[model samples]
Target: MPALVLAAAQTAPLAGDLSTNLARHLDFIALAARHGVTLLQFPELSLTGYELALARNCAVTLDDARLIPLAEAAQRHAMTIVAGAPLRLGDDTLRLAALIFGPDGAIGHYAKQYLHPGEDTVFLPGEAGLTLTLDDDARTRAALAICADTGHPEHPAAAKRSGAAVYSAGMLLSVNGYAADTQQLQGYAREHRMAVLLANYGAPSSGWQCAGGSALWDENGEHIAHAPANGEALLIAERRADGWHGRSISLD
Candidate 1:
């Protein structure tokens, strides 16, 4: 398989600043493009910022004006992009989910099905999750998840059963209580024999601190690439004959 460059975008989104967040995302996209990255993954709730209460006003439809520029950019750069967003699914619901834009301007979205308690009060649970090809040419079957989705074994199991070769999530992984989940997530990937990638959030909000250290773990229980605790970074990983290889892309 051709090497796949997966970027983990860790950032703290300032509520209601879609333009600024988009601008930052564009810069990271450009940087990843320069590295010949095939796909770029960002933290959950990246587009609208992760402010829950604020997400209502920031939530947008897939065809909304905000996504146009991003679609164009993805097409131009030939990079598959997945990031978190709030999409207006109905007159009464907002789904917290990951939206994918292919290099050819194709759009696919995955809603977060697994809710972490309080999420039920604010967002509508996703009716379905999606698995799409990561690279159109090479065509690696891929599935996406949001923050808490990765922590649950059932979600990843569902992805594997759904014909996904690799599972990816834009997780807002917190520094505290992460070691246990990280280990479990890794074990799940290894046992299921699937590749996994997590893009953690860097800038903490809600008085909750996070260590934006993105991680990549392959089949057979091996961590190929990861960022240190609490920082912004771009992690690059490759699929090889034996398993996988990876490193970090320094944004200097």
Candidate 2:
């Protein structure tokens, strides 16, 4: 079998700027393509920063035409792209979501199951978990998480029970929360024996100064790759015949 290459795009999103952020996402997709990445995940609320006040205005449905370019790029590159956004649920409900664009142009989404403190005011919590099978291979099942969801031990534990081999999270981690948040992810990887990946914002969003330490850990919980604390970068990890290897590439 071919190696499975996965990456985390640690981006610096502009607050409430969808057009500009879309362009940046395209650039990141192109770059990931050049590196033969098969799966790419972006930080939480990557499409419009973590600005709660603008979520409703920025929320998009699954059929939103604004996402056509992203679906097209996914098909063109044969890469599964998971980017964060605010999803429009019912007429007035909004949820923090991860929009998954498959290489076949099929769009699937995962709403964040856990909300941090004040988030309930703006977004509804998702009810179920989603595990994706990559390239029709059973060996590459990936489970998705968003921000605060990772803080709950049962989240990853349930993913493991669901047969996920990879646990991926998209988040906005401030400097004060980085250490504890990452420690939990690392523990999940070791405990569940699943490769873990974290994609965090590289700049401030919604008034929070984000810590840009996006990273990846092998199934054994060995820290394989990491970006610096304050810059845009791509954290790539590939599972080869020998083991999982990783590298950090500056996107700046």
Candidate 3:
């Protein structure tokens, strides 16, 4: 496997502000490109921002005007970017993870199979756990989802069953605490021997802070690094000869 510098852009997102959020996403994409990153992951619903009822109006088709610039950015940089957005599949609407243009163009898509208890009011449940292998850029057999999608075993475990080398979930969490959740997820990584990345939102919206503690767990489920509370940072790690070596990227 090639050395892939996978990055996650963690930032604050304002409600109903597509341009602001899109700009922030592009900024991070540029940052990652400068570092020679092969793939970059953004938080769930990163383009239009996460509150569903408030954002349904902004949701548009794949060719919608707002999404054009993002596609251009992906094409311009030749990087793979994953972000959450509302998608129109036939007549039915879905809250889907849009895996946009990469070296191979937009080749993969995954929908949230489980809608959280509170989220059922805004989004529809996605049926299948999607898996695909890109053009040898990264033999990524990944299963995609948003925050709640990772809580269940179906997504990650399904990826393991599918033989994925990596598993990812874009999230909007709270800084109040997700200690136990991370603990459980780490154990899953160790038990499955897979690389997992939880891309999260750093911004506080709707009175609760989006937990900014992002992590990368290697095959042994070792703690690569977790972000401290109330901060914007990137936790970077590399799979070296001995093991994964890492350092913090302070973006505050």
lDDT of 2 by residue, 99-162 (tens): 9999999998999999988889999999999998876656779999999999889999999999
Where in model 3 is the C-alpha error above 4 Å? 96-99, 132-140
lDDT of 3 by residue, 103-138 (tens): 444544566777777667666777777654533754
1 or 3, greater by TM-score? 1
lDDT-superior candidate, 2 or 3: 2
lDDT of every predicted structure (CA atoms) = 0.79, 0.92, 0.68
Worst 10 residues of 3 by lDDT: 99-108
Ranking by lDDT: 2, 1, 3
Write the residue-wise lDDT of candidate 1 on 113-164 in tens digits: 8888877888888877788777656457778888788767788888889888
TM-score for each candidate, following the candidate numbering: 0.93, 0.98, 0.88
TM-score of 1: 0.93
> What is the lDDT, from 0 to 100, of the residue 156 in candidate 2?
98
Better of 1 and 2 by TM-score: 2
User: Which one wins on lDDT?
Assistant: 2
User: Per model, how many backbone clashes are there?
Assistant: 0, 0, 3
